[model samples]
Target chain A: MSEATSELYSWRASIIKKQLMALTGLMMCGFLLVHLAGNLLLLKGSDVFNQFAYLMVNNPIIIGLEWLLLLVFLMHTTIGFRLILENQRARTKAYAVRSTVARGSKFAFISMSVTGPLMMVFIIVHLFDLKFGSEYLVVQSDLEVRDLYRTVVEFYSSEVNVAIYIAAMCATALHVQHGFWSAFQTFGLSHARYNRLVELSSDVFALVILIGFGMIPIYFLLGYS
Target chain B: MRFTLRIWRQAQQETTGRFVDFAVEDIPAEMSLLELLDSINRGLILESADPVAFDHDCREGICGMCSLVINGRPHGPGAGTTTCQLYMRSFADGETIVVEPFRADAFPVVKDLIVDRSAFDRIIAAGGYVTVTTGQTPEANDILVAKENAEEAMDAAACIGCGACVAACKNASAMLFVAAKVSHLSLLPQGQPEKSRRVLTMVREMDQSGFGNCSNEAECEAVCPKEISIGHIARMNRQYLFAMLLSGERS
Candidate 1:
């Protein structure tokens, strides 16, 4: 193929990958919100949270949805990896000689190229630690949901893990802070009034995720009985 | 009022350029930006310094020759206003203004604030015309065009071959300029004979000219004196795709 054809093909691939990443990433954000809500049941004591975990595990429809979520997660990660590589290739030059003054939203959107991958690594480690590790899935019993809570608490009690979690949560916050509103802009849903609403929503969601996730670790660190 | 002007000066195409500072006094607020520069040039001539050379014609803003990056914006701060139309009143008194030529790989600086935008001409020369016979003039309105289509074509045709869009773009992309030309001619029935070939050849020439790809950041639109929408870009992409597919069939 000619160089133009190759460039065109790669450009089209990057555009498609961006669309896939946005769709799956937004869906995963929804999952995170729901997942966090379910996890918060641990604050109510072991029985309440374990019952919630039991319902999720026992429902056949929920089981199918879990697989769907897994598929979306994998698709998101694969496309995200492709996007990062393409972005790097597009910016082969070391630094920009002429830097334009970009709006705040544009700056945050561009920086997503960096934070997306960091969040990917955090997601993998998180899944491995809680889902595949000795907490819940290895035991195959709803009772280990309580053990999962204790493991989470114990994990956060460490300064290193707390630091990592805090850092990861901060990355997540920035990612969602830009991602949420940007998705709307990409889809052409930007009116001035609605644009402000989307911006507000992005900030609120980012704050909730940062404080919500960060607080979990701090809760244990603070000796919450 | 006196104003400090940081103007880029280059002696030749191969010579390195630098910002040379000059102060101009007693400039009227009603004076357009080009007039302000003229005042500075007059001062340089008196001082036996080489007067700055720039391009301008038809100070009415139709000629598209007055291209300058004023205050870090293409055509200054006025929306949908050409540089020649921007008056000194828009800027603060005694303001330090930086002025430079439009920088792009396709457009190289010739001297002072002037750059050779001949790449656009070459892209147009590639295939921007209709392949109609040159015998006799056709009847008036021989091809019935819809009013909306004619209006859109006129809007696109209003582009005066200015490199403002390219200057305003962060990536220095010329997609808007190419799109406007292609769209203007492609929309009419008289130009239909060579529409597909025109888009394909012109787009190929545009790419070969080393202009960067359009990332749809809308900076071009923001600073476009014509206020050309990026929608023209989408239309251009669609037209190019159709041309490619049809040209493949012809081959």
Candidate 2:
């Protein structure tokens, strides 16, 4: 990042910042998709869940991927927060009476300024509780794996943990509701006729992420297999 | 028609302002909002009071001079029209109307219901034109343009530079305004010469002018008097990204 290169991007720095936000956020969304698939294995009970967890833990490139995921997450969160600050500077004075046009998702879309930071805080809490809280080892065959299923179940058996997880999932869902389509728009994939399809899929995506992850704590707490 | 009007009055940029209510009677429905203001100003002058100061030109809505945010929406209630084109019929009799200047960090209040929109002029001067001189409207048939591209270019060219997009956006973003200016040029063959350079320069100018970034909300489109689509914003995004990537390696 030299002066000349930085100057080049400064010509359209706002668009560049937006594109960077989209790119990093898109990578995290891809990870979320994969993570949702992995988390679904919990419903299969202890052995099945532990088997998937074993594969995840034993992968050779897992450390490299974890670093990359962390980097992407940090970049996304940092840019989003920076943009929020810039937006504040952009409008130092507020209108005495301001109103927005009638749009269904407008409220949720603007709520990204609030929900995005909440998602970051929630991610830290989530990783602390589930990823690094404790590890239980169990053997089924000739090898042993961490019984993450038991850890997850025991963690969610508490009302506080379930409440926090569910609440955070709602924020995450609100973030994706706008982020999904906004990413495509930033990438220049938006069109008049097909935008409805993209917007529809964004809503569906948000709902799936909300329910798919939200059901886990409830399922574990209720002792439902 | 009789109505109660709440109008913002700022004596100067450094001075604070508040709403002053005026009651008007026997207004004709066919009278344009500007004429209504004219009558109000005349009455004010008769009473030896300061007349309401506003902006207007061409009264037909083409000059992009009229600036007013009536009842919270820029250019009043009706769609695809400017403040000068707004008629008294748009509102109901005996209703109370609130009028304010177009609010933004860049466009500050000049007086009663007038904001300095000169930032748009600077943005346009950045690169919103084709340097290639065609001298005059030399035969339109000579340079062939595809029907669809020509239509799209015309659509983007419809922006009036009213600054309503910024006023309507929650972040006060000028993306719709800049996108319209960028897209109007990028679509034509004449604009192809300076395409990359134009978008880069104009968008940079817009950001430096203290406007916020678009968050993909369609509120700008909803309030745009010319009905400029956000599709141009998408087109501007594509143009901007490709321009950056193509010329990025040089720096």
- Candidates in order, TM-scores: namely 0.69, 0.93
Candidate 1 error regions (>4 Å): A1-138, A141-225, B241-251
Report model 2's TM-score to 2 decimal places: 0.93
CAPRI classification of candidate 1? incorrect
**What lDDT would each prediction earn against the true structure?**
0.73, 0.84
| Best candidate according to DockQ | 2
CA displacement after TM-score superposition, residue B203 of candidate 1 (Å): 3.3
Worst 10 residues of 2 chain A by lDDT: A1-10
Chain A only: TM-score of every candidate? 0.83, 0.91
The CAPRI class of candidate 2 is acceptable
lDDT of 2 by residue, B1-251 (tens): 99998989989888889999999999999998889889999999999999999989899888888888888898888889999989999999999988889888889888777789999999899889997665786776888889999999999898988888998887788999999989988888989888888888788778888888788877899989899988898888888889888754333
Q: Give the worst 10-residue stretch by lDDT in candidate 1 chain B.
A: B242-251
